[model samples]
Target: MGSEKKSRLPAIVATAVAVPVAVVAGVLVFNAIAPKAEPVHEDLSPVAVEVPALSEEDAVVCLALTATAPESAGGLQARPVEGGAGAAESVMAYGDPAVVATCGVEPVAVEDTALVYKLNGVCWYSDEAGLEWTSLDRQVPVGVSVPETHEQPVDVLNDLSTAIADKVPAAAEAPTGCA
Candidate 1:
């Protein structure tokens, strides 16, 4: 009886080890044979951007905002800026046509009748042509320029709003039209 029990223990231990080994081997083989999706390669040339001189306070805010900005927005990856000094800290660009954003820019001038939108805890105002969208609720307004090629430009704004909300502080008062 003792001899029989010892024999059975070895079999049970072997089965346990063999099962896991087989599963790992199968997974590795399957992965090796699986089809892989092609990686997307985008032109990462540094984009040229112009920014007004920033106040010390505004520069601090811009630095914080850009540091926390996402690597990708609206399905497009962030790209470098062309300016030699301080531009990369204040500006970010994305996509082929380049959805460009400049931090610490002058706020959008909102007329009494203009439409103001609050999305993802950020308020926004868009230009008549919808090519430009600016944050109306942040301490320093963030301006994002969308190309005409993007059909739904506001969608791109929505993607960026969350980061803007998190990193940038709310304005002392909401924009005139935005409650």
Candidate 2:
């Protein structure tokens, strides 16, 4: 009885060890053969914009400008606008509010205190914070909101100027003393 019991103990120990080894080997083989899943990307939702109303003619011009706007700005792809208000305007946003462009904005009143920048044959008026830029030379005003994250806002303006110039007609003249 003792000898039989000793043989059974060795068999049980060997079976226990073999079972675990087999499970580990099976897992490794399955991992090697199974297809790898593609990495998941973060969902970038559209930015919410509040746009002002526009005149009929201005709305048409805005639509044209929006249609011609670039698909991407500063390496960020354009996304749809959400929560917009007003008539016949379009909003183009990129990268969770990194850059935003709105057409059909009311013409900015260029005050003596305003800072004006001229680039790519277009004139832009900036508010005190310089966060917003309104095109002063277009018949129908267009505004671009550039976040502080951008090192150079002028580069973004330059990139969009061609589209604005091509689609939106230029005013007879820009505001006085605006360069």
- Cα lDDT, all candidates: 0.86, 0.77
Q: What is the lDDT of candidate 2?
A: 0.77
TM-score, cand. 1: 0.74
Colliding pairs, model 2: none
Which portions of model 2 show Cα errors greater than 4 Å? 1-43, 84-89, 112-114, 177-179
Give the lowest summed-lDDT range of ten residues in model 1.
Answer: 105-114
Cα error of candidate 2 at position 29, Å:
29
Instruction: Residues 1-179, candidate 2: write the lDDT tens digits.
Output: 99999989989999999999999999999999999999855236767787767777877787887777787765666677776564225676765545788887778887665568877778898876777999998887888898887767777788788788889898987876554
How far off is residue 77 in model 2, in Å?
A: 1.8
lDDT of 1 by residue, 75-171 (tens): 8888888776789888989888789999988877777677988888888888789898888889998999999998887677777888888888999
Separate clash counts for every candidate: 0, 0
